[model samples]
Target: MEMKERQQLQYEHDLRNHFDILSLSRLDRLKHYGLHFAKYAGRLARGDAEAKSRNETLVDAFLVALSAANALNQKLQNAEVDTEDAPSDLAFTDHAGRFADACEKIDHLEEFRSIALDANAAITDWIVRNATVRGVDLDALVDERRKQLAQRAVYAPGS
Candidate 1:
């Protein structure tokens, strides 16, 4: 296969492996949420109207994931939940935090933010490149999606 094709395949393989690992670890909620993010990102890269309408930029997406990891870490540290459920959250939080913390210091508060910013940059580059290859007019798509979203907001319940 061509080098680009090979890279794409590898990316897909890595994503599947990561998903499998998360699922096997019984973190299905997190796995499903992550998968949805991936799927939405893919759709946006492919110029899907609804996905674009969601208005989730790469930065927004990265922040959401980072926030979840941070929340998990905080919850684990605080130990506000029952003991039986604490172990699993603690384990998952530690693993998630380690991705950002080179030293794995419990007090490394900004480590995850740095990781998330780097990840956002990489993901945004990848998505823009892929969307260009797909002949997606991102600016036009965003404009249209914004109009649709605005209309929806106008008629939305309690809005």
Candidate 2:
């Protein structure tokens, strides 16, 4: 392939990886909400207190945003553009500002999980795609580490 074509492929690969990592981060956040926040919201909604409904609504909105952010990050990471630097308008100050604001308002609320989940997913996805597009196997360096601990369990001294 021509140099330009190769470069284009590289860009695409990198973008996709970035998005995958981002998605991973998002998934983590959703998992957190699924485990904790969602229940809290449900409780508030069912409680007799007047503020409960509003609180639940707010929490629900934040959760939705968290999900959206995760999905978007995953898409970007999968596109291999993890480090492509989001445009200014899409930066945390912009796209995630609402999330940040919601987080600040939440005191007893659990820690926001969106960023962590999205980032991990984006990075992991990027690595996988990058290896494939570069015609290299990352199994030894990447997969080995991820699977080693699990594999070790299967071969434990007692087993």
User: Pick by TM-score: which candidate is best?
Assistant: 1
Estimated TM-score per prediction?
Answer: 0.35, 0.25
Tens digit per residue, CA lDDT, model 1, 22-92: 34432333343345445545544465555454334432333334333332332112112222221222332
The window of 10 residues in a row where model 1 has the poorest summed lDDT is 74-83
List clash counts for every candidate, in order: 0, 35
Estimate, for each residue in 1-159, the C-alpha lDDT of model 2 and write its tens digit: 222332343334334433343345543444443334434434444547545543233323332333443343433333443443322212222323333433443443655445434543333343334344544434333333323323445444443
Q: How well does candidate 1 score on lDDT at residue 81?
A: 21
Candidate 2 shows a clash count of 35
lDDT of 2 at 131: 41
Ten residues in sequence with the least summed lDDT for candidate 2: 86-95
For each candidate, what is the lDDT? 0.37, 0.38
